[model samples]
Target: MSNAYTSPIPIKRTNLGHALASEWTKIKSVRSTVWTLSIFLILVIGIGLLAVANTQSDDYQDVPFTVPAFFGLMLGQICLITLGVLVTSSEYGTGMIRTTFTASPQRHRVLAAKALIFFAIAFVASAGSILLVGLMASGAHSGPEAGDIAWGGTVVKGGLYVSLLGVLALAVGSMLRHSAGAITTMLGVVLVPAILPGFLGIWESTQKLGEKMGDYNAINSLAAIFQIDGPDSSTGSSQLVLLIVITAAAVVGAFALLEKRDV
Candidate 1:
């Protein structure tokens, strides 16, 4: 008679949780994640404090107390973008993607896990830094002239905006599968629209178009959110909606390509 055989390990069906756990592990174990996020914090908090320290209470007369954080975030966002690219593209570079796919055959689940994990990390870091800076600025510069700035809205929207940019960068990285290329494309996505409007304004034929672009570009959107450029109705909601649509499209494209491609 044959002896009955049984395994000691428990067997279970895999789901999104498994993929998320794997992604969480990978993200936390990597050094790039630490370095990029650390720099992001330093740039945002450091420059924000400096801006607040250099100014007097009267400086809040026309703008919100949160305005100083905008200066730091402009530079700090690059670090987030870089981290986003690295999250996806670095695995491809090291040929770790094959193992990932092998372990999690449901490719879209893997992607969703990456996006969710990265977005959460980026959003928390961004919001925390912005809120910290805003509180410090408010303590230093709050006055009647500040006009009851909405600090809560500023922090939440600012975090969402920056986190979406990083998510978009992750989508681009997934498509390009190259860290440097994806980072550069994201930078151009942010900078070119903001910069090109100025050059275009020099030409009479494109002046209106340039003005419109300048009004709706990322910089203007972010500045509007922080109330740094004063109150504006046109820039804030529309720009965020545009970004959401574009990022959704990019994420869909990444998933479609992931299913069709060899790797």
Candidate 2:
């Protein structure tokens, strides 16, 4: 009734939590999340059980006893990366990103929230499957010192690897703004290094560099997480450093583009 009438409801300033909640809802609501994660879990658990059914005496000589679970996880990683790319790229594909930006108006915050949520979900699923596989492997066989193998450390590292890979995929998606392109790029990044090095082996002078590339690649990082030992083996530190550095650079580029480009 008065000229200076107050509002009935209070307005609260938004923060990162709001963004996170939004991303969580979006991720959960998507069919891609369900399909991709379902496939990942099935492959990891099913392959792990198969490995347990065929546990060999020499299997754990150089690798952790739970190493069989990694075979399925290795294949399942592609799906995780696809989901990561789709998280941002699909929005761009269908123009949902405009709505997201309209609601938030803070692009970087949105990206951060998406990355955090995806990382958490991917890590939990990967780690849970790996742990279940490890437990199944340990108990499935009654071999001597079955429970004494280095299971915890390698399993944890594998989870971290998958989580980091998902983050990298998300950053790539934000930069490319195309799901297919970003997914292809992620696949190349993960696989080419392992194969390219072999081609480079023909040149004697380049052989060392090629070997280094293979050892430092994303595929090798999965092996490193398994802590497999041999001349071809690598530790997680080098692979993690390489992948994280590239992902960080991509994320910075994505933020820069967000500011310069119109929705």
Candidate 3:
């Protein structure tokens, strides 16, 4: 028989979809994803509901119900960041990355797949939870004085915030290849740059620069999207652009490192 007729196995080129499936399997099978996301939901939904229960209808008279949801999400960002780091870092920790690279042989493809899968999972979960809490908070505080409920921008923005944070963490993990080290770096990414400006603001010489940093910082940008931050309309756009820029840079760095570094 000819080769075509006699061959029992067909050779098919692997693509991103296959990689994504593999990554999805990896992420789902891991305990970190479960524990991190579970705590995220509890903190987000629990705090939001608890806040609503304590507040009177008079509270809604001046504030939008979306406020409480944003509050919960702000604190829950830690869970998202941790999960992101674990996605890639845990593999390195357990020496599974070598096997993964051996199976795929295409490093960039694996990274991209991981990013897409994690982003989808994180964004959907966060957005859905925020919407649920927002609706519930609105109902609990609804009255004639309760103004229009704008959940679209806030929900999407908040979702993107957490999702992008996870992506950043993943990128950092790939570069560092250590779970603890990457997690610490990311915590600084989320915490330090945001507050350093405040400390610098104490010096009159640096006050202007500090104010600029404060205005463009991620947390303030997130708050600005929820309309609870400040009068500056530029904070939202500035923060969004900053995140996209930083994430894009990290992604490039991750791919470059993957090529140069040994598994």
Candidate 4:
């Protein structure tokens, strides 16, 4: 009997869900993620404790919401940025992005998955940090705001603000596409606008521009978000708006880059 010709069937390609799972596994597997998160937890909680220890209460109203938030930021931003840089850039660093692109050719899906994962990570970190601050600040103090300490609206807003900062970093990382470049840009974006005025001799220019820049700077704007009083048209709204607009632009730019740039 003559044998019939036979052909092998091709393997099916995995869907987006599988790609997401694979990406998640990559993120969780990184040592930098673990270390950065550990340091973030310790710094946030430790700072809260330190702030409470150093605090002298005249009136509960004296306890500025900005205080503990700053305490957290002192440590949180550094480590959070580290994590953010690693999230997307590590793949580039390891040449894993090629495989990732192969698996999920829709670049937007990769970014969306990364954003979702990083957002969740930020939320958990913020919650822990806020809870630590609340616990530390729960004791005796002065001012009509004594009741406000435990239920302080600032803590809630502060947590969300920190989460957004993480998102901003991720967006930035995507735009820069290099870990060091991303980090440098993040620092410059936060610091340069505020610091330049202090050094420049252009007093008149600095005042107008400084005030405007101050309004738009990320650090300044985040300070607004974490402020007890909350932000309106005044104070740091300009800075906050600037940061938001920049973040939006960065995300859009990242998407465009991913769509066109060879991974």
Against the reference, the lDDT scores of all candidates come to 0.89, 0.84, 0.85, 0.69
lDDT of 4: 0.69
What is candidate 2's lDDT per residue for 206-235, written digit by digit as tens?
Answer: 999998998887667788877766324555
lDDT of 1 at 47: 95
lDDT (tens digit, per residue) of candidate 1 on 140-187? 777765556466888888888989999999999999999889999999
Better of 1 and 2 by lDDT: 1
Worst 10 residues of 4 by lDDT: 228-237
> How do all models score by TM-score?
0.94, 0.93, 0.93, 0.81
| Clashes (candidate 3) | 0
Which residue segments of model 1 deviate by more than 4 Å? 1-6, 144-146, 232-235
In order of lDDT, best first, we have 1, 3, 2, 4
C-alpha root-mean-square deviation, candidate 3: 2.2
**Which pairs of residues collide in model 2?**
none
Superposition error at 201 for model 3 (Å) = 1.5
Candidate 4 has what TM-score? 0.81
Q: In terms of TM-score, which candidate is stronger, 2 or 4?
A: 2
